[model samples]
Target: MDSRSVSSRLRELVKFLGTVQGDLSNVTGPPSLLAPSSVVEVGHAWAQRPAVFAAPALESDPEKRSLLVLRWFLTSLRSQLYVNGAPGVSIKKPLNAFLGELFFASWTDEEHKATTQLVAEQVSHHPPITAMHIADREHGIRADGYARVEMTFNGAVNIRQVGHAMVHIDRYDEDHLVPLPDVKIRGFLGGCMYPEITGTYQIMSSAGFVTEIYFSGEGMISGKRNSFQARIYRREDTKRREPLYEATGIWSKGWTVKDVRTGDVLEVYDVEAPENAPMPIDIAPLDEQDEWESRRAWAGVLAGMASGDMRIVLAEKTKIEQAQRQLRAQEAAEGRKWEPLLFRSQEGEDHAVFHELTEGTGWRLFNERTKGVWKVDESKVVGAQSPYRGELTPLG
Candidate 1:
């Protein structure tokens, strides 16, 4: 589509999205440019490559294990931004997730003989935050994190992620803190909107290794899009002149890692390689899924969007929002507060592992920003059910 037509379409979309509940004011335009999936599904996209996520568990050496973790993070970044960065397919606003909404998926890693499970929930609605937990019990790898987009319009749409994730490997007793990056969705007014992530982010581990990654697309670094450079060095080194390993390339395609001392190739990760393909995620059939489940709850809205029926999309979306409002009102009238079913707010040293890992680093929990430092409350997950007192809240 040309810029003129795209501009008109974007204006209409922005007007409609502005009326939606929660923080959706800064979404870029055009229905055709929008993702058919909801935000909860988008949250699960980061961990789509399950084999890469489980790779670190297979490495026994501390240095190799650290590099594997960095590889997993880079691979996941490609999965998360591939749609927005791809040609023809560009930046599209996803449906905002409603509070209490749940998403569940799992994939089996044949090589590891392990099942990796993912659970994500819309823990907050006003500021719009999604908390996710992924665990491979057999491999003893667990990652817990929350995210929300903070958007701004300055010619182009600038999006900043407002949370952090921590991954813990049980075998090594290591904790790795992963930080998010800043992204810009450009070319929107001219019709073909695309995303570019530009900034520096890091992965700090308790094992005393820090992987500093810099994303400098186009003019800043190379003339290519999605270009990045990463260095893995000891935490004590402030200057970081001598790194143990170095990685450089475009994340959308692939990157190469080299041993700094030996000047030998270490690993090459290609995004389009058959081995890097995302494993199929499995979920229960819609008929058998709980009313609170994301797929079941958003069935009507998703179907509407897929069929290009805006009427159905608006009606179904409004119905869910209204029910949530009424539920909140009832709780307020009874002088009670709504609590998350699968997660709990963490305060102080409740998450001692995370605190210890992030001690010297500039990173912080940002509890106030996310409403609370949300962590999985395993006790509540047993025989999981809706937290609502009476019947499940009717959605869709």
Candidate 2:
């Protein structure tokens, strides 16, 4: 937490960035810059607590549940934007996920008495895509998605997230399509690297409802940081002139939901409170996880980082990267492509799936890409069970 240590960490990260730049210049594929821990560890940073997905499970009404889902999604942005623990905090770079690396965790919602499980896998390395699946069988809710980032550096770092997520509630037989927002990393050269999320995203439900969200940062003359506004509309209404619900607030702080027609405030989200605190995810014991599992694979590197020994960190990190490179080379020699373990990709048919899910609703999939839509393997899910209990372990 000391400024000197923070500065030192930033310097180290910048040095790693230089290596990445050089590697890219040489036309190598994505450079591996694994921090002292696993990329799976970085994933935990996104949802420091687990309750984000639990909100929908707690809601019984389809329409109200959709609103809760949107709120949960917005709340997650707080942690996602401040990955280095908090604003202005300089932390080590996140570990780059290796192909096929798996991360599994689960959390129990004490209030709802439901268990939520999350399964994430690094499905692709060249484009660095991660596939994730979350399920709460008790509440008949599930979500599946994939994430990939395209980054560009021009004074400030701009990151465009390319992915879509689908949340399904069996009770309502509704599917919610969620898109990610763009991110900007500010003050890189000034030595205060922090993330600023910007741009518009949408959440469309199969129940003829659509929520349009706009993200913005503090302006010189007006606007506060992490400001966002969302309007929900019923798709069947052709004019789209009136919204059913509206929400406005600073994402990091909280927000208020209002019934637009009645002009009555419905709910307020106070994210900082202990009752609304993030649910803790339980990870399987390191020894029980497979060698390809995130925790076990990066155990040495994590230990090195905890001990503040960069020598050990680098050695372990290099070993993992080298092994990955060798595996790729061997696969190429054998004329084989690495296949994902838990997700299946469908090319040119993502829009079809979107249509199927949002059939009755007027909402259409926007910004649909051809990188192929990735879906969880239901067969695998049917057989797999949560590996951990309610007790959460330190990520390191």
Task: Give TM-scores for every candidate, taking all chains together and pairing residue i with residue i.
Answer: 0.89, 0.84
Q: Give the Å shift of residue 216 in candidate 1.
A: 1.2
Q: Give the best candidate by lDDT.
A: 1
TM-score of 2: 0.84
lDDT of 2: 0.68
Give per-residue CA lDDT, model 1, range 1-396, as digits (tens).
Answer: 676667777776556545555334333334455566667766556566666777788787777777988887887776576554464555677766777888888887676576778888878776778888988888889898887677766556677788778888988888888887878876555466667888888888888888989987755354777789998888888574479999999887899999998999988878888877777889999988878888888888879888988778778777887887787788789997767768877774576766776776666766677776788877666667644324756441
Whole-model lDDT values for every prediction = 0.75, 0.68
Q: Residue-pair clashes per candidate, as listed?
A: 0, 1
The 10-residue segment with the lowest total lDDT in model 2: 22-31
**Per-residue lDDT of 34-92 in model 2, one digit per residue for the tens?**
34444444345333444556566666666676687787687777666665456545322
TM-score of 1: 0.89
- Residue 210 displacement (Å), model 2: 0.8
Best by TM-score: 1
Where is model 1 poorest over a 10-residue stretch in terms of lDDT?
22-31
